[model samples]
Target: MSTPLRLSTVILPVRRWHEGGRRSWERAEDLGFHAAYSYDHLSWRSFRDTTWFGAIPTLTAAATVTERLRLGTLVTSPNFRHPVTLAKELITLDDISGGRLTLGIGAGGSGFDATALGREAWTPRERADRFAEFVPLLDRLLTEDAVTHRGTHYSADEARNIPGCVQRPRLPFAVAATGPRGMRLAAEYGQAWVTTGDPRLSEAGTPRQSRDAIRDQIERLGKACADLGRDPDTLDKVLLTGFTPDKNDPLRSVDAFVDFAGRHAELGITEIVVHEPVPGTVFAADESVYERIATEALPRLG
Candidate 1:
């Protein structure tokens, strides 16, 4: 049988926990979202000067207020994070959330995060190379009681994560990728594969073109899994909306979302993650319509 469609959301960490941040998390759980993620960045585009908080701490706090809501980073990267330190924190988060943490990882882009650490930004090839080393080392760090490894980019010196993750081998990894090497890593290490349509087509492409792009991506991901002697069916396909040409159309109304989601679902997307409406930002939308899509549209899909 095909995997059932699941609805999730991304809540930007643009508010203080006291000033409505905590409530957004609670509301997501109350709305019955399967998972709620926040961007893992020192700061993001446009909102760079706003009240951005640390993704780890924001998630840690969310874990306390939520019971069933799975918490995660939309996509964490090696831009400013070290595997050893990240593994230790993830273990704690898993225990706190009762095994509800999904680690969304990626080869980070050349955004503000690239230069925030006082170093030159890595080239595309360099980013891919570093990611190749980062994921495996992180895998070992999370599963093993202690690890010592020296790689081209990162190293762990007998780093220990005793009483490891509550999720047995480790928490699930939702790897975000659109390239070959990255897809291979996803097939090798990810529980799910994530995409945001195609960046190249985001500007001029129509919704149909975006759908076709994602369809092609999913096919490539399957081939990558096959080459690695893994079952592609075992990996969930996640679509993080808003980057597509259709942008916020899916959140405009319950019917619009159901229609938008249905088309993607037909293309083997198992999970659809939308952004929670933010009033004054690019992600802004009608709050009631967003809620209706969650409370009403999802059930219709089922």
Candidate 2:
């Protein structure tokens, strides 16, 4: 048995924060996306111009413009910031978002980022082990009145976090795990499993890549939860689909739109976040992603 999954997609809020992360966010809100998200990268290779200034700042700016949408970092790495500091920032953003914040996290393992952070890029298993410990600890700190935690990687001395999560106990947490260990973490600790669609081996394109692999990942995620003595069906699942349509050009037909969403739906992906990249900013491709999204993708997904 697996948890009931609904629509959730991580869209590129902006190509780069400094350039137009704010402007892209306005489109996401207008499109009625359930949850909007941005990638966290200190250094980007393919698109050097696009860099992560700070996901929280961009999300905070989004909070001011929209009220109904939920915002999160597609996957913020754990190595860059201290645990307490990260917790505090998320808490503040939680308040700013009016309780519509989902915290998606992962390990920093890219060559450039790992070296820059001074944290060794551990293997998948090691990263999973750390996340398994960290996610729950963070969850407790944000949800409980006070937290006394001690683990292999972190220790807290009678931590008392103020203004606990504004959301219910289920302060949405997305673990963007693509491996087995990550799958287990998502099941045991994550409120939802966040996935970037199927990526091609060729690294020359935008992250607007996806495939039916989501079904397999979702199944793996379910089994992981079951192993932890938890009901897989009790968890929440969100899958992100990168939708790039031609704006002024449009998708040609409504049936085409249905076909696109239906493919994801058939694959057990209920919710999708349409990522629109900022032109001449973070995205090296084209600016049409935004217009195509508003006219074709969002309307159909909505």
- lDDT agreement with native, every candidate: 0.94, 0.64
Q: Estimate each model's TM-score.
A: 0.99, 0.79
Q: 17-68 in candidate 2: lDDT tens per residue? A: 5466566677667765566776666655555454446667878888897788
Clashes of each: 0, 9
Candidate 1 per-residue lDDT, tens place, 1-302, comes to 98999999999999889999999999999999999999999999989988899999999999999999999999999999999999999999999899999999999999999999899999999999999999999999999999999898998898999999999789999999999999999999999999999998888999999999999999999999999999999999999999999988888888889999999999999999999998898899999988888788867987
| Runs in model 1 lying further than 4 Å from the true structure | none
TM-score of 2: 0.79
lDDT of model 2 at position 238: 58
Residue 67, model 1: lDDT of 96
Model 2 misplaced stretches (Cα beyond 4 Å): 1-19, 49-52, 197-212, 228-234, 242-257, 280-289, 295-302
How many backbone collisions does model 1 have? 0
